[model samples]
Target: MRYLFPTGKGYQRKWLGQDVLSGVVIAAVSIPISMGYAQIAGLPAVYGLYGSLLPVILFALLSTSPQFIFGVDAAPAAMIGGVLGGMGIAMGSAEAERVVPVLTFYVGVWLLLFALLRAGRVLRFVSTSVMGGFISGICCTIILMQLPKLMGGTAGTGELPELVRHLAGVQVHPLSLGLGAAALVILLAAKRLRPKFPMAIVVMGLGALATVLFDLPGHGVACLGAVEPGLPALHLPDWSAVSLTEGLGNSLPVAVVIMAETLLAESSFAMRDGYEIRDSQELLAFAAANLGAGMVGCCPVNGSVSRSSMNVQYRGKTQAVSLVAAAGMAAVLLWGSGLIRLLPVPVLTAIVISALLGAVEFDMAHRLLRADRKELAIFLAAFLGVLVLGTIYGVVIGVLLSFVDVIRRASQPSRELLGVISGQPGFYPLGRMSQAHPLEGVALYRFSGGLFFANIDRFQKDVENCVKPGIRAVIVDASGIVSVDLTSAERLVLLYRRLKEQGVRLYLTEHIGQVNDELRRFGAGELIEEGAVRRTLYAALEDCGAAEGEVKQWIPEEMRHAVPELLRQTQELEWAYGEEAQSKLDAMTGQVLQTLEETKPEQREQELEFLLERGRWQGVIDRDAILQHLEEHLAELSRLLERSEDAVLLELEQERERVTEALRRQHPEIASYLAAHREELEQRFQRKYPEAARHIHELRQRLHQLPEDETKEQR
Candidate 1:
C-alpha cells in the first residue's frame, strides 16, 4: 500500500466496494439528465444516451480512478448550446447535425493533445480563489439558462421576442410544471439520504410509474420517447471544415474551454479521492471517450464532478466502477431507452432542479469574505464577467487581471533592515516590531527578494531611502539574498563607492558562497574592499570594537520571535523517530551498520558536495562555529550503552527518545536523526574508529545521567 500511493494498502482495498455501488447509483440517476444536457448541446436525445453508454466505458478503461465516471457534463453542454444558438444552428437542421460531429471531434482531439502534454500539474498554479469564482460563474449561467426549460414552454428557446412568441404558441402546462417541481424535491431528498440510495433514480422511477399507472401519455405531459440502441460508429476527427483565416470558428475556443473544465473536474473529484493519475492521462481519457462517443453519434463528453463525487462518497477505489456504470447505461439504452419517452418533461425538469441544488456556491462566498480587497475584486469581476458576458470571455478577463497583478507587484519592490536589539542576542528587523526597541545605531537591512533587472533601480532607491545621516554603517544582509546578476552587482559597486565617500561603511553580511564566487569571477568583489565583507554583523562590529565584550554578548536572554529556517517547521524540529527524513536516514544507516558489523579495515572514498543552498558557511560570527561548540559538548561523555546485536536497526532507533528529550530542554528546536541515519555521524564515529562508537554509546548514557550539580547550577 505504501508503494502504491506512499501510504498503507488497507485504504485502497476498502474503497473498492464503495466505488461499485456509487457508480451504479450515480449512473442510474444521471441517465435522464444526460439526455437533457445533450438536448442543450444541440445533440439528439439519443445521442446523449449514446454518450452516457460508450464514452463512460472508454473513460473507465483509460482513467486512473475507478470512480471517475466521464460523460457529457452540464457546463460544456451549455457552452455548446450557447455557441450553436449564437450561430443560428437550431436542432433538427442538416447544418447543425453536420457541425455537431465536427465539434465533438475537435473537442476530443484537443483533450487528447492536452493529455499528451501532461498539463495536470498546472492545476497547482490555479489558486483556489480562481476556481471558486469560475465555478460560481458557471453555476449562475446554468441556473439562468435552465429557468426557461423548467417553466413548461414559457421559458423554452428564443430571445426575449422568441420566448414571448413561444409562450403565445404554448399555454401553461400545469401538470408538467407540478411534476417537474416534485422531481426536483425528490432528487434533493435522495442525495441527502445517501449517494447509494439515489432519490433521483427512485423519484424518476415513481414519476414513470405514475405515468404508466394514470395513463399520463393521454394527458398533455411530455416524455423522452424512443431511443435506438447499438455500438458507437467509428469516427475520424475532422479538420476539413477548419479555415486558416478563421480557424475552426467556435469549436476551437469551445474545445479549449471544455478541456480546461474537464481536467479541473477530474483533478478535484478524482485526484481528491486519491486517484493516482496524471492530468494529461485524464486528458487523453477524455479525448478517447469523446472520440468514441462522437463517432457513435454521441454528444461530446468530459469528466463529471457530481458522478465522480458520488463514487468517492461511496468509497469507489478503482476505475472498475466506471466500467460497471457504462455497462448498466448501455443496457438501459439498449432495452428501456424508448420507455424514457413516456416519462413527463415536468419530472425531468424537477430532477434537474434538484441536481442543481448541489451546485450552490456557499463555500465560495465564505472564502471570498476572507479574501483581501484585490482578490475579492478579481473574484467579483470574474463572477460578473461569466454571468453577464459568458464563460469564455470571463476566464479571459480573469487571466488579464492576473497578468496585470503580476506586473504591478514586480514594478514596486520592498526591502527590510535586519538587526539585533541592544542587550539582546538573536537578530531581526527592528522596524516591523511595533513595541520593540531598536539598537540605536545599527540596522541590518535586507533586499528580501531576488535582485533582477526589473527591480534593481527600485531596490537601489530603497537602499538610499533607508540610509539617513549619521549612521556608522549599513549592512546589506546578503543572507536573505539568493542570487545576484552582474547589473545589480555593478550597481552595488557604485553604491559601495558612494557610501565610502560619505564615511558610511558598507558591509556584506551572511553572503551565499556561490553568489560570492560569481561576484569574484566577475571581479565585482574587488570593487568593494575585502575587509568590508564580514562573516556576520556582530564580528564586523566587534573588529571595530572590543572582541571580548562582543563575545560575552552573544547569548540571548529569551527566544527570538521568528525561528531560524531549519527550525521554522516545528514538526521537523521534533526529535521523533520514524519521521520521513529519519526513516530514510535509518534505512540508509542500517544498511551501512549491517556492513559495518562484519567489515574489515574498509577504505571507502565518496565524492560528495554540500552546496550552501540557503545559508552562509562563513560569517562575522559563524553560526556553524556555535553549532560545532554544541556538537563538541555532545561528543564528549562518560556514560555507556549496551548493544543488543539481534534487534532490527529500526527497533533499536527508538531508544533515542530519552536523549532527544534532554536536548530539547536547551535547543528546543533540535531534531534527532537516529532513525534518519545521518551518514556523517556514522562515517565519523560508527565506521571511522572503534572509539567513536564508544563515544556515541557513552553520550547516550550521559544524556540520561547529567550531573546533578551541573544541572542545578545551569538552572
Candidate 2:
C-alpha cells in the first residue's frame, strides 16, 4: 500500500493546510496554460480541463515524487499537433478527436511496457546538453505556432519553415495585437519581479473583465465561446479509427518525450529538496496518467515544470497538493465553466507564450558556451535540427551525436610517458613537468581509461615510441586502467613478447587484483606466471635493477621548523600539482610564519584565519595538512614570541585537537588510516633523521604528561 500511495511516504498532519493552499495556487496557474496547450494538441479547451482532473489525480496517487505536478504541457502537445497536421486532419473535427485518443492510448501502453522493462536506466545515456537543446527547440517552435493566434489568425502548423511562411502571410488585427502585446509584457514583468505569484490567472481574469467592460467580441477581438459545463464522461478510445501499427509508430516519439521531460524534472526536484525518487515507479505513474487521459477522451498529459516549480516555491510538502489541485479543476468544470468563454484568445495566447519562453533553457546554452564549446556545438545542432527537420529527427540527431562523441573520447584515451621530478615522490609526465626526467635505462608509461579493442593499437604505438636505446625496462602503470577486453589482453601478451626479443623487460603494476584474474582467464596466464606482474612501480623498478641508489638528503638545523621535501610530497598533492609543488609548500610555510611574527597579539588569531583564506590556491593543498605543519612549529613559535613553552604548546595542542576531530568527522577513512599507522610512520621518520627524532621524542613526553584537567578543558 505504501508503494502504491507513495505520497504518504513522508506525510505529516501539520502539512495539510500548506498543501491545500499550494494545490489551489497550482490549479490557478495550470488552468490557462492547459487550455492553451489543448488548442496546440488540436483539441477543444474543455478537454484540457478534463485532462487536468483525472490524469493529475492518478499521477498523484501513483507517483514516487512528493512534489512533481502533472498536466498537459508543451512538448507532447506540439509533437501531436505536428503529427496531426502531417496527416491532414483538421483541428477540432470528429476524426481528429477519435484519432488523438487512440494515439494517447498507444502512448500509455508504451509507457507501461517501458516501466515493466525498467527502461528508465536507458535515459542515463542522454546528455544534459542534448536535453536542453531539444527542449529549447520545442518551446521555440510552439511559440511560433502561437503567434498567429495572437494576431487574430489561425495557428500555424508543421516545422519552423512552414510556420514562418504561415506567419509571414497572416494579416494582423490591431485590437487583438494590442491586447496580446500588453498581456505578454505584464506576464514577463510579473515573472521577473515575483515569480511565485499566480500571474497567469490574474492576466486571464483581467482579459475576461476587459471583454465585458469594452465589448471585445463586438469590437472584433476574438474570444473563446461558451464551453459545455459538466464533468467529462468515461469514454474509452475507439481504437478502430486508426490502424495499430500506424498509431504505435506515431506515438513512440510522444511517449519518449514525455518520459524524458518528466523524469528529468522529477529527478531535479528530488535532488533540490534532498529526497529520492524511484525511476521505475515514476514511469508507472506516467503510464497511469496517460491511460486516464485516453479513457477520458483527452489529449496526452505530462509533467509540468512551471507548476512544479511553483509548488516547491509555495512550500508544498506532499501529494496532498496534487489531490487538492484535482478537486479545484473539478469544481471549475462543474460550476465556473462559463467564465472561460469571456477570456480573450489573444490574452490566452500571450500567457502560453510567456510560459513557453520561460521553458527555453537559455542558462544551459550559456553554461555550455562558456565551459565547453564542443558541447555547445552539439546543443546548437540539436536546436537547429528541430527547427528545420521536426521533433523526432531533432531527438535522433542529438542522441546520435552524443554517442559519437562518447566513442571518439574512448578511442583516444590519455597516454603519457612518465618520469621523476627532483624533489617529488611520484612519477610525472615528461612533457608537462619541466624538472622531471626519465630514470637511467627505464621508461614508465601511464594510460588513463579502460583498455579496449578501439584503443589497443594506440597503446602499443605509445609503448613502442618510448622504448629508446639504453631503455632496459618498460614499466606500465595500470592504476588508471580499470578494465581490459580480451583483445587488449591478447595484444598486451604480443607486446610482452616483442619487448622480450629486444632485450628489454616489460612489467605491469598498480592495478587491482581483478585484472590478474581476467588475464589468467584470457589465455595469457604466462604473463602472471613469469613474474611480469608487480604490485607497485617501485617494486618493478627494483626487480629490473633500475632502482640502484638514493639521493643524499639536505637537512636543516631545526627540523621541527622545516618539513622535508620528500615528506611534503603526499599522493594527493602529487596528483594535483605534478612537479615543483615543493615551492608552493615553501611559500605557504613562509607566509604563515611571517603572519605570526608581525601580527599584533590582540588580532593575531583573526589575522591568521584571513591569511589562510587568502592563501588557498584552488584547493591543491589540504587544510588539515596546513594545520599539522603549524603544530610542528610550537617550540620555534614560543622562542620567537618570548612566551612560556608550556603556554605555546597548550595553544597549538588545542588547535590540533579541533582539526583532528573535524578530519575524523569529514573523512573517516583517512583519519582511521593515520591513526592505525601512526607507529609505522613514526619509525620511518626516526630512521630518516635520528637526531631530530630524539629531540621530538623528549618534547612529546613532556606534552603527554600535561595536567589532565588542562587537557579536559581544551577538549
Candidate 3:
C-alpha cells in the first residue's frame, strides 16, 4: 500500500499549507492553459476543466512522483487535434466530441499496456535533442493554428502549409486583434518580471472584464458563449461515431506523445529533486489519468511542465498539491463556470499562444548550437519535419536521424598513431604530443571504440597506412575496443595473416581478458598461442626489441640530432606554422643578417633587435633555439665569404656577445627562462641519450687540452 500510494511516505504537517497554496497557484495557471489546450484538442473549453479535476486527482493517487502534475497539456492535445483535422472532423462538433473521447480511451488502453509490458525502459533510446526538436515543432505548429482565432476567426487546422494559408486569408477584426496583442504583451512581460506569479489567470480575468465592460461581443469580437455550472458527468467512451481501426490508429501516436513527454518530464523532475521514480508506476499513473479523462468526456491528458514548475516554485512537497488543485478546479466548475463565458476568444487564443511559446525549446536549441552542431542539426530536422510534415512523421524523422547519428559515430571512431615521449611514461598520440616520436621499426596504434563489421575496415585501413618499409612490428593499443563481433574477428585474423606475410608482426596489446576469450571463440586462438597478444604496450615493445635501450638509436634518424625536448618544440612549430617552419626560420635569419650588414656599427644592435621583433620568431621557436640557429648561420656566412676564419669568427663573436648582453638587459626574465629551459633540455638529453652525452663531453675535454698545449708551447 505504501508503494502504491508513495506520496504520504514523506509527508509532514507543515508541508500541507505550502502544498495547498501551490495547488491553488497551479489551478489558476491551469485554467487558461488547459482551456487553450482543450481547444487545441478540438474539445469544448469546459472539458479542459474536467480534465484538470479527475485526471489530476487519479494521477496524484497513483503516481510514484510526489510532485509531478498531470492534466490536459499541449503535445497530446495538438496531436489529437491534428488527427481530427486529417480525418475531416470539424472542431467542437458532435463528431469531434465523440471521436475525441474514444481516442482518449484508446490512448489510456495503450498506456496501460505499456505499463504492463514494462516498456518505459525503451524511452531511454530517445535522445534529448530529438525530444527538444519534436516539442518545439509541435508548439510552433499549434501556435500557427491558434493565430487565426486571435483575429476573430476559427483556429487553423492541418500542418504548417494549410495553417499558413489560413493565417494569410484571415480577415482582420480590429478590436479582437488589439485585445489579443495586448494580452500577449502583458503575459510575456509578467512572465519576464515575475515568473512564478499567476499572471495567466490575471490576463484571463482582465479579458473577461473587458468583454463585460465594453460589450465587445456585440462589436464582432467572439467570446465563449456560456459554460454549464456543474461538475463533469462520468460516462463510458462511445465508439460508434468513429470506426475502431481509425480511432486506434489515430490514438496510438497521441498515446506515444503522452508517454514520451510526461515520462521525460517526470524523470527530469525526479533527477532534479534527488528522488527516484518507478518508471512502470509512472506509466500506470498516466494510464489511469487518461482513462479518467476519457470517462469525463475530456481530451487526452498528460503532464504539464508549466504547472509542475509553478508547484515546485511554491515549495509544494507532496501529491496533496495535486489533490488540492483538483479541488480548486471542482470549485470553479461548480460555482464560477459562468465567468468563463465572458472570456474573449482572442484573449484565450493569446494565452494559449503564450503558453505554447514557453514550451518551445529555444534554450535547448541555443545550447546545442554552442556545444555540438551535429546535435543542433538533429534538433532542426525534427523541428522542420514536424512543421513541414505532421507531428507523427516529425517524431519519426527525428528518431531516425538520432539512430543514424549513432551508426555514423560507431562506423568512424577516433584512431591515432601512438608514440613515446622521452621522459613520459605512457604512450601518446604522435600527432598531438610534440615530444612524442615513433620507435624505429615499430608502430604503436590506438583505435578508440569497439570493433564491429561496420568499423573493421576503417581499423584495417588505418593500420595499413601506418605501415612503412622499415616498420617490422605493429602494436595495437586495444584499451578502447570493448567488444568484437564475428565479422570483425574474421577481419582481424585476415589482417594478422596479411601483416605476417609481409614480414611485419602484429600484436594486440592492453586489451581486457574478455577480448582474449572472444578471440579464442572466434577461431583466432592461434594468435594467443603464437604470443601475439600481450598484457601491455611496454611488454610488446620489449618483445619487439624496442624498449630499455638508447632512446636516440630507437628513435627516427631525422629526430636523433636534437634533444627530445627541443625536437618536440620544433615539431610543435611545424604543426602550427606548417612544414615550411624551418625554411621560414632560415629566411628570417637571412633578413636579420642583411639588416646587420646594412646598419652602421653603432645602430647594428638596435637594427637586429628591430628585425627580430618584426620576424615574430619567438612565437614559433624558443629563444634558445633561435640563438643557436643564428650562431650556425654566422659560421656559414664566414665560411662562404672566405675571410680569415679566426678573425671573422672573433668579430662575429664580439658582436653576438654585445647584442646578447643588450637583449638580456632589456628582457632579463625571458633570458633567464630560456637559460633554465635550455639547461633542463640538456639534462633530459643526457638521460635519454647517454652515449651521445659521453661523446660531447669527450670533445669538450679534448678542446680544453689543445688550448693548454698551445699556451705551453708559447711559454
- Using TM-score as the yardstick, the better of models 1 and 3 is 3
TM-score top scorer: 2
Q: For residues 483-561, could you state the per-residue lDDT of candidate 2 as single tens digits?
A: 7889999999999999999988998877766677677678776676454776557656766878565422112224312
Q: Rate the local accuracy (lDDT) of all candidates.
A: 0.57, 0.76, 0.75
Candidate closer to the true structure by lDDT (higher is better), 1 or 3: 3
Scored by lDDT, model 3 comes in at 0.75
Badly placed stretches (over 4 Å) of model 3 are 5-22, 32-44, 64-68, 74-100, 238-250, 264-277, 305-321, 549-715
| lDDT string, candidate 3, 461-521, tens digits | 9889878999989999988988788898888889989999998889887666677767777
Scanning candidate 3 in windows of ten residues, the lowest lDDT window is: 568-577
Q: Which ten residues in a row have the lowest lDDT in candidate 1?
A: 604-613
| Candidate 3 similarity to native, TM-score | 0.70
